[model samples]
Target: MIRILFFILIVLALGAGFAWLADRPGELSLIWQGQRIEMSLMVAATLLASLISAILIVVWLVRVVWLSPHSISRYFRARKRDRGYQALSTGLIAAGAGDSALARKMTARTHGLLSADQEPLIHLLEAQTALIEGKYDDARKKFELMADDPETRELGLRGLYLEAKRLGANEAARQYAERAADKAPHLPWATLAALDYRSQTGQWDEAIRLLDQSRAAHVIDRKEADRKKAVLLTARAAEKLESDPKGARDDAQAALKLSETLVPAGLIAAKALFREDNLRKAASILEKLWKHEPHPEVARVYVRARSGDSAIDRLKRANKLEALKPNNVVSLATVAESALEARELQLARAKAEAAARIQPSEGIFLLLADIEEADTGDDGRIRHWMNQALKSPRDPAWTADGVTAPEWLPVSPVSGKLDAFEWKMPVAQIAGPVEDGNVDMADEAIRSLPPVAIAHHRDEPVQKPVEKVVETPVKATAPVKVEEIVEQPAVKTIAVPVPTESVIVPETVKTETKPAPAKTEEPVVEPFFGRPPDDPGVRNDSAKPLEKTTFRLF
Candidate 1:
């Protein structure tokens, strides 16, 4: 626009000058080379302007002709470069789409047209094509080539890491991930892989440092960073708790500052404080954790915070915990166990029953059995409760990846995941529900097994206990004393009706009378009950197996 306006201005100025010259005409006479030339001013001006314009035009034409070769060469080069880029783009798309043939074709075309130094995508396309074609060696070579280049180092490392994982080479994968993360902490995959490996190897300090790098690079959010840091600090605290109490306490306390409700952090902090003889601080921490989330470890540590304290004092502490978290199963169980330790059988039984009413589990039933043993010393009642416990649902424990741990762990042993352990029910058998009155699951379970011979000692007294025998669907803990299989002895045979399915339906299956194949000369094995486990003839495996052979008493 500016050029056009300037050109117009110049033209208008010349026209105005011409008009002025025409209005006030003058003569121009030049004496040169012994010759005299005369002309009007307007005509001389026109001829001079035309000669300068013609000279400029001739120069422009000569310059164009002189540079034609270079110009043509540059045009073709640019066109070839564009085609290479087009092929590179198409190859990348084809590789991602799993079109190995097109990807390979385009990769070759792009490689022919473009140098890998100038276009990094060419190597990437080739590597991807090799991977898609199941040529692992070629892909790995290409990835190595990429990794050697400074510009494509991260991409190459990612490819190498994936390939290592595919080949189940964890150490190689870890090295690649760590190398990539060290060079560029902002890369998400590299950072996460590096963190996981560091945690798995128990490199707590290094892991924390790497996590900080990730946080600083904004690869992880503030909330996630805080949580992960808390877990790491808690794990480190647990490691140092025994050897360096004060140091563990500091680390745990710091973790608590980040996540106040972390149970493991609070537990470690309290224990470490206790080890340091900071009873007041430890007790305070335990109370705070209990109020937030009731945990068994917290209760146990709090109840026995002072080693010098008597059982009654521990019971008092347990009472305080129960008061803080009213009606909770953990709190009630803690109180009951403490009371039992203090010899307060009544209180213990009452608390145990109350907890059972709230939520019956193996732990709760076992606590009840403990109370019974403490109170009456009755073998019958204790076994009854023990059987109930065995029949109860499984209790919750620290489980991760289908594996249970006796204590909390920072990472899963199975999957190497962070913060994986949880206090939840492990996968176990589901027992039958308990019945009211005289229907004891333990005795019933024993009776459900195959009949075992009960040989009596001379001094023993026997009594017949009537029971409707039925097979249990689940296996019993009762021991089946097996006699070695031998030659069949002559014995009477009785027809026993059994259902086609797992259940024994006496009324459904027709009972047919069959004649005895042999004479009743040999003694028959008759199933019996009504004797305590201490009976000389009854060799019971479970300490709590029901009367004699586990039959309900009539």
Candidate 2:
């Protein structure tokens, strides 16, 4: 709007000036080549303006005529470049779509139209096509060539790293990743790969440095960086514990400071402190750890912190630990074990029972058995507890990837993952119950024993007991006769002879009545609980036969 106004004002000023000149009617005179001429001022002014306009038109025409060929050449070049770019774009799309044929064709056309030096994307497209065709060698060469160019160096390194990983070249992959990380520290993949390489190779200090770099670059969060650093520090401590206890102690302390919940770090630091005779410090660390979560190793170490301490002292220490984390299975078990060692049978039995109630496990049951044996020297109670121990749920251990370990480890041996081990129950395989027939046979064996035989096997005298008899089903073909003999106190004993050719069915005694051919009668062997009377648990190779035996209560 302002330009329009200014143009109107300029035209008005020119008109007013022309009108004023006309009204004034001034005369103009000029002498050219000794000839004198006179004309109106307005005519000379108009003629001057016309001549300037004509000069500008001629100059513009001459310039256009001279530069026409170059303009035409540039237009054609631009058209070709546009076509090449179009092919490249299409090829990239096709490559992403997994169309190898179209991508290959577009790659060839793009190469023909655009110079590789001028169009870097053309090289990328070609490499992608080679990858699509499974031409790894060609792809590798293309990426290597790209790596030489500063503009694509990081991208090239990433590509080469992936290829190296695909081909299982660990060293090559690490080199590429390190190069990429050097070029661009913020690249998450490169930083992570370098970090993993350093960690896997036990270059923990280097790994920690890379982790810091990653955190600075915002590739990893502060929490994650701290966690990874803790893991690395703990691992380093474990590595150096045997050789350099001081250094290991420092590392472990640092790790525990970062993450107190880390069991390995706590254990390692406690161990290092103990080795240095800093018993109070080690106990302090373990007590703090026990407040969060109770661990058996921590309890053991805490109890053993002062090696000169007696069993009663250890028991007091364990009680202190249990007080920190009340009702925990580890705390209870530790207390129970300690009490048993201290000959505090009542306390041990109570703690063991409490531990079993909290988490029914084999360890707790075994501890209970120990308590029972120590408190009451009865074989029956001991055997009962042992059987219960065998049937109890398995105890928690350091488990990783389905593998259980008796001791804690910083990493999983199977997967090589840091802090992989966890204190938990191992996965148990599912098994179906025993067959009904087997269960019935076992039940029948227990029932078939005479009352006198049962009483004779017991270590204690029997009180007045009620007796129940279970009838066995017999086959019609084989019938056996039972002879009864009356005994004192309204007791009676019955004995049944076995048929020669009959199989014993414990649940339902069935016999075949069919008699074999009258041949020399061999001594009949009755099946006692599905075995011969004299058969030991193991099979014997020696053969002895023809001894007939009668059933007796003893």
- Judging by lDDT against the true structure, name the best candidate: 1
Candidate 2 positional error at 314, Å? 2.0
- The stretch of ten residues in a row with the least summed lDDT in candidate 1 is 505-514
Per-residue lDDT of candidate 2, residues 389-501 (tens digit): 66555777889899999887655777556567888778662321234443343244233322222223223443444344554544435445543332221344334434545
TM-score of each prediction: 0.68, 0.64
Which residue pairs come into collision in candidate 1? none
* Backbone clash numbers for all candidates listed: 0, 4
The residue-by-residue lDDT of candidate 1 on 134-194, one tens digit each, is: 9999999999999999999999999999999999899999999999998998998898889
Error of 1 at 525 (Å): 23
Q: Candidate 1 lDDT (Cα, whole model)?
A: 0.79
Each candidate: what lDDT? 0.79, 0.76
